[model samples]
Target: MRKLLICILSAVLLFFQARAQENIQLKSGDLIFQNLDCGPLCDAINAVTQGYQGNKFSHMGMVLLRNDSVLIIEASGKNVHLTPLKTFLSKSAHPHYVGRLKPAYQKLIPTALAFSMAQMGVLYDDQYLYNNGKYYCSELIYDAFKAANKNKPFFKLFPMTYKEPGSGAYFPVWKVYFEHLNMEVPEGKPGCNPGGISLSDKIDILGQYK
Candidate 1:
C-alpha cells in the first residue's frame, strides 16, 4: 500500500540521520533531548514548558560512554536502562540536541553517572512525582546530579502544572490521565521536566545530532 511505502521511506531517512550523528564526539553525562511525538499527553506537557533556543522537548536521556561503547541511560519503557545512541535517535521525530555541563560542573560527571548506573532496573514513575522512589526521564537525571552535588539540588524543581497556563483549568488529557490512575492531580508538587532542564544555565547546548 502507499501508506506502507511512505512509512518505509520515513524509516530509511531516520536510519541515515541516526547514522550521520555518529560523528558527534559524545561524552558521558551529556544530555540528549527528544520530542517523542507521544500524542496529546506529550503536547500537554510541552504546553506548560519550554526548551532552550526555542526548541521543544518532552523526553531526555544522558549519554554513557562505557567500555568503548556509546549508550543512552534514560528512564523509559518499564524501567531505567541503557539504549544505543542510534536507537535513541531513531525514536525522536526531531533532530537530537546535545547538552554538556559547563567546565565547573563537568567534574560531577563521574559521580552523577555512577549514581545513575546504580539505578538500573528502577521503576518508571508514571505519576511524575519527585522522590517517589521511581525514576521518570528528567527526574532521574536531576537526582543523579543532586546526589553528585552532595544532596544539593542541581536543576530547580517548579510547581508542576497540569493545567492550561493562563486559563486556570486542568488539561483534559491530564484530568483523564490521573482519573484513570485513580488519584487527584498533584498540581503544586515539586518536579522537573526535560523542557525545564533544557533551559538550565549549568549546561551548554552543543548543537544538534545532525
Candidate 2:
C-alpha cells in the first residue's frame, strides 16, 4: 500500500510539472526570451526574400512563445523609418495595393503600420528606391526564429486569438502607453486618424503587450 501511494503521488507531481512548463508569462519589458524557436520562422521569411541583402531587411524583431502565451519584442532599428501601411498605400503607384493584401504578408502589416508612426531616427535607403524624403516599405523585417525550431514548439508567424469577434486590439506607441496606464484603450471609428485603427478592425489579444 505504501509503494502504491508513493507512485500515485509521483504521477500527480509529474502532471503538475508538465502543466507548469506548458506556458510562460512575459509580464515585464526587461524579460529576455531565450526559449524562442527562431529557425523555421526565419527560414520562411528568408525564403520570401531570396538573395536580398538589404540592411533594413536584415534587422528583425524577437518573439518568444511558450504554450499559449507569446511575447513580441520590438527592438530599435538603425536608420529605418517606421512607415504606416495606410500612408504607403495612399502613396503607392500600384493599382492593386489596397484592402487586397496577401495572407502571407498579414503578419507584417501591424509592424509596418507601427513603423510608419515611429519617428525616423536615422536615414537609410535601398539602392532600388529613389525617394529621398520618404522611406520605402521593404525595409521592415519579421524574424521567424520560432518557425525554424522543428524540435521545440513555436507559435504561428501571426499569433492571434479567438476570444473577440475579429482580430484583437492594435495600437501605436501612444495608445499602448495609455492602455498601460490603466485607462481605456482609445477606441474611435476606423479611419485615417491617430485614434483610429491603424491595422485591421479585429480585436487585440489581451495578455500580449504591444
Candidate 3:
C-alpha cells in the first residue's frame, strides 16, 4: 500500500510539471521545444562543472526557459548566483561584466557563463595551485581567471587574480564549451590565435585533443 501510494504521488507531481512546461510559451526555434535530449546535454553539463577545482569556485547548473520572444538561460551554482537585472546594474561592483542576455541563454549559455569559464581555466592549469596541493579542476579555473580579470565579463566576477595558462584548451571543454562559436585571442596571433569574429561555424571547443 505504501509503495502504491508513493507511485501515485510521483505521477501526480510529474503531471503538474508537464503542465507547467506546457504553459511556458516559447519562440519558434528554441532548442528546448524540439526534443528533450537529456543524454548529450547532461554529459555536456557535467564536463563544464568538472572543469573547475580548488581556490573557491562555484558549481553551476544550467537551466533553459523559453518565452514568446526569447530563450532564457538561468544558472544555479554553489557560490555563484544570479543577480536580479534591476539590482545588478546598481548593486554589482562590475556592472559592465554582467551579461545582458542572461534570460535568453539557458539552452547553451547560462547567465553566469563567463565566471564559470574562469573557474574552468584554473582547473585546466593545475600548476597555479600546486602549492595549496588540494584543488579540483573547476575550482582552479575560477581562482586563476578571477585573479586575471582580463575578460570583463569573467574578471568582474572574480575578486582576485592568479597565474593563468596561455591557452584556452587548459580547462575542461564541456564547462566552457563553445559550440559553433569562434573565439580568436589577440595574444596568440596568426598560426596560434588567428583572431576573428565567429561568422557561423558551429564547433565544440571543449573536446579532448588527445
Strongest candidate by TM-score: 1
* lDDT of the structure predicted as candidate 2: 0.30
Model 2 reaches what TM-score against the true structure? 0.19
In lDDT terms, which candidate is top? Answer: 1
Ranking by TM-score: 1, 3, 2
Evaluate model 1: give its lDDT: 0.92
Q: lDDT by residue for model 3 over 25-61, one digit each (tens)?
A: 3332121101112344333323322221111112212
Candidate 1 structure quality by residue, lDDT tens digits, 41-70: 999998989998877899999999889788
Q: Look at candidate 2 and tell me the lDDT of residue 166.
A: 41
lDDT per model vs. reference: 0.92, 0.30, 0.27
Output the TM-score of candidate 1. 0.88
Query: How large is the C-alpha RMSD of every model relative to the true structure?
Result: 6.4, 19.1, 17.6
Candidate 3, residue 174: the lDDT equals 31
Order the numbered candidates by lDDT, best leading: 1, 2, 3
Q: Over 4 Å off in model 3, which ranges?
A: 27-210
